[model samples]
Target: MSGPRTIWRSIATGLGALALLVCAASANTASAQAPPPDIGFDQNLGAQLPLDLKFQDENGETVELKSYFGKKPVVLMPVYYKCPMLCGLELNGLVRCLRGLNMSIGMTAEKDFEILTYSIDHREKPALATQKRRQYLAAYDCPAANDGWHFLTGDEESIKKLNEVIGFRTQYDEITGQYAHAAGLVVCTPDGMLSRYLYGVEFEPKDLRLAVVESSEGKVGGLSEHILLYCFRYDPASGKYGLAIMNFLRAGGVLTLLILGTAITMMLRKERGMMESHRLLEGSTHG
Candidate 1:
C-alpha cells in the first residue's frame, strides 16, 4: 500500500509541473503577440475636427478639410497610401461595405454621404494618392464615387494635428520603415463634429449606414431609417447600433394603439352607414 501511495503522489506532482509549464508557454505567446504601446486608438467621441487644416487632393490641388464637411456626413480614414499590407485590407473592406449600401455617394436626393481618406505619412505624395483613388474608385464601380470619395495627402504638421484631434495613435518602425496603427474610421457630422468611431477593418454595411444617418442629424436617410434610429441606439463601447429593447417595446406599443384606433374608426363609420339605410327604408314603408 505504501509503495502504491508513493507512486501516485509522484505522478500527481509531475502533472502539476507539466500544467505550469504549459501555462507559462501560453502567457509568453500572448505577450509576444500583444500590440505595442504606441499602436492603438483613444476614441474621442464628439470631438470637433480641425476644419482649417489643409491637405492636397488626389489631383494635387490644395483644399481645406472644411471643404469636405458641412455638406454631408464624412467617413474619415487615416491610412498611408504606400502601405503594403493592412491599409489595402482596410480599403478593400470599406469598398465592400459601401457597395452594400442602398444609397450612393454625393446624391443629395438619396442617402448622401462622403468618404475622406488621407495619408498619415506626409512623405507620401499626390501621385500615390491618385493611384489609390483610381484603384478604389474602379473597384467601387459607382459613378457617384468619383464625386463623393476623395483621397488626400498633407504635410507632417497637418497630418499630426488631424490625428491628434481624432485620438489615432500610431508608431513608426525604423527597422521596417513602416508604421503600426490600429484599424478604425471616424464618422463626423456635416458640420465637422466627430460623432462616432467605428473600429476594425471589417465593418457591417448597416453599421456604416446608421452611423452616417445619425451623424447627419436627420439631414439624410428616409422614413424607415428614422424609425430604425428610433428603435436602435448606438453603443460607444461596441461601436455599433444595437436594438434598444425599451425603445422597441415603446414603438410596438404605439403601433398597436394606432392600429386599434384605425380599426375602431372604420367600424364606427360602417355602423353609422347601416343605421342611415334602415331609417330611410322605414320612412319609405310608412309613406
Candidate 2:
C-alpha cells in the first residue's frame, strides 16, 4: 500500500511541473507575437493637424506648421535623425521613390508638394536636422530639396502634440537608448487635413505620385493622373493604391462608347458630303 501511494505522489509532482512548463511556453509565444507596446500607427484619417505647433527647422529658424501648409500637400515623416537603422532606410527609400517619379509628377518639392520631417526624439537638435538634410539632399540631387524638404526638432510638448495628431505612436527603450517607431509617411491636404498614409520602407513611385495628387485635391496632377485616380483607389489595409475594378471597367466602357460615337458621326458626315458632291456632278453633266 505504501509503495503504491509513493508512485501516485511522484506522478502528481511530474504532472504539475509539466503544466507549469506549458503555461510558460504559451505565455512566451504570445509575448513574441504581440507588437511592442511602444510603437505603432493609428490611422486617423481626416484628422486635422495642429498647425500652430512650432519647431526649429534645419536652418534653426522657428517656423509654424501652418507655414508649410496652404500651398501644396505636405508629406510628413516622423523619425529621429540619429536612428541607426529604420529611419535611414525610410529616408533612402523616399529618395529612391522621388527619383523614380514621372515628369508629370514634377521632381521639385515645394513646387509640387512639401516634405516635412520632424524628429521623434526631442533631445535631437536643429544641428542634427541640418546635417541630415544635407546628406539626403546630396543623395536626392534635387536643387529644390534645399527649399522644399525640411527637417525639424522641437520640445517634448510640441513633439507629443504633433505625434498624437498624426497618430504616430513611439516608444523609447532605456536599455538601447533608441526609439522604436513604425515607418510610414503621412500625406496631408493643403488645408492640413490628414489624407493618406503610405507605409513601409520601400514605396512605389506611382503610389507616391497618386498620394500627392489625391492629397492635393486633383490640383497637382495632369489629365493622365486624373484618369489614373479615377481607375485606382487607395486601400488602407495594403497602404497602396489598388485598381478599382468596377471603376476601371466603367471608364473603359465610357471611352469605348465615345470612340464608337465619334467614328459613327464622322462616317455619316462623310457619306452626306459624298452624296452632295455626286448630285453636283450629275447636275453639271446635265447642264
Candidate 3:
C-alpha cells in the first residue's frame, strides 16, 4: 500500500483514465488561489459541523447546513463541478459503487444514506451544479438519487469554514488552472457529526455499507451487520480498510458479558416464579 503523502498533478483526457504529469510550481509562478503543500484530508471523528452555514442547492434554493440533517447518515463529498479529470473519475467511482448496493439513496431500508456534493470552488454556480447533478444522475440511472443526492455551491467564506471543520485541504494549480485536492468521502451522522472518512476513488460496497451503518451508530442495520466492524477498520496510511486487531481482542469479552447477563436474567425469573407458587399454596391452606 502506498502512503497518503503521495501527491502530484494530472489531467484527465476523458472519463476512462487520468494522465499523471509531474508539474512543479515555482514560487513566483504560483497562483494566489493555489492551496498549500498539504492538499489532503485530515479526518476529525465526531466533529460537529457548522449547521448555520449557508449554500445554494441544485434547485437554486438557499439552505442551511441543518437542512440535510436529522434523517440519515450523510456522505459528504467536496468537488468542483467543472473539474476536468479528477472529480469526474471520483464521481464515476462513487456512482459505480452506489449502483452495486441494494440500498437506494432516497428510500429507507436496512441500509439508507444521503450524499452531499459541495463545490469547493466557490466560482461554480448553481446552474453548473444542476448540470453536473443531471449528468451524474442520468449516467447513474438511479432516479431515487435525485432526491437523496445534493449538489451545493457556497461562497468562498462558507466553503473555507466548512473545509476547516472537515480539515479538507485543497489548492489550485496555476499552471494547470485546476484545483489539487484529495479524493475521499466523509461519512457524517444524522446530527451533522463527522464519523468516518474513506479515502481513494474506488470504494468497496462492503466498506461503504459499513461506513454508513457505523456513522448512524448502528441505527440503520441489525446486529449481524456489525460483525464486519469487529474485524475490519479504516487504515489511514493505506487509505483502505483492513483487519481490526483491537476489536478482535475485545469481542470475546463482550460476548462473555452478554452470555452472563442472559443467564442472570433466567435465574431471577425462575426464583420469582417459585416464590409466587409458594404464596398461592399458603393462601389455599389458610382458606
What overall lDDT goes with each candidate model?
0.87, 0.91, 0.82
Model number with the top lDDT: 2
> Clashing residue pairs, candidate 3?
35-171
Ranking by TM-score: 2, 1, 3
Q: Kindly provide the TM-score of model 2 when superposed on the true structure, using C-alpha atoms.
A: 0.84
Instruction: Please list the residue runs of candidate 1 whose C-alpha ends up more than 4 Å from where it truly belongs after superposition.
Output: 1-35, 102-111
Candidate 2 C-alpha lDDT tens digits along 134-232: 999898887855688999999999999999998999989888999989999999999999999999999888898899999999889889888889999
Residue by residue across 81-188, what tens digits does model 1's lDDT show?
888899899999988888777454333212387889999999999999999999998888777457888999999999999999999999988888899898889899
Model 2 residue 113 CA deviation (Å) reads 1.1
RMSD of each: 4.1, 4.3, 14.0
Better of 1 and 3 by lDDT: 1
Model 2 poorest 10 in a row by lDDT:
101-110
Score residue 233 of candidate 3 by CA lDDT.
Answer: 89
Q: Pick the candidate with the highest TM-score.
A: 2
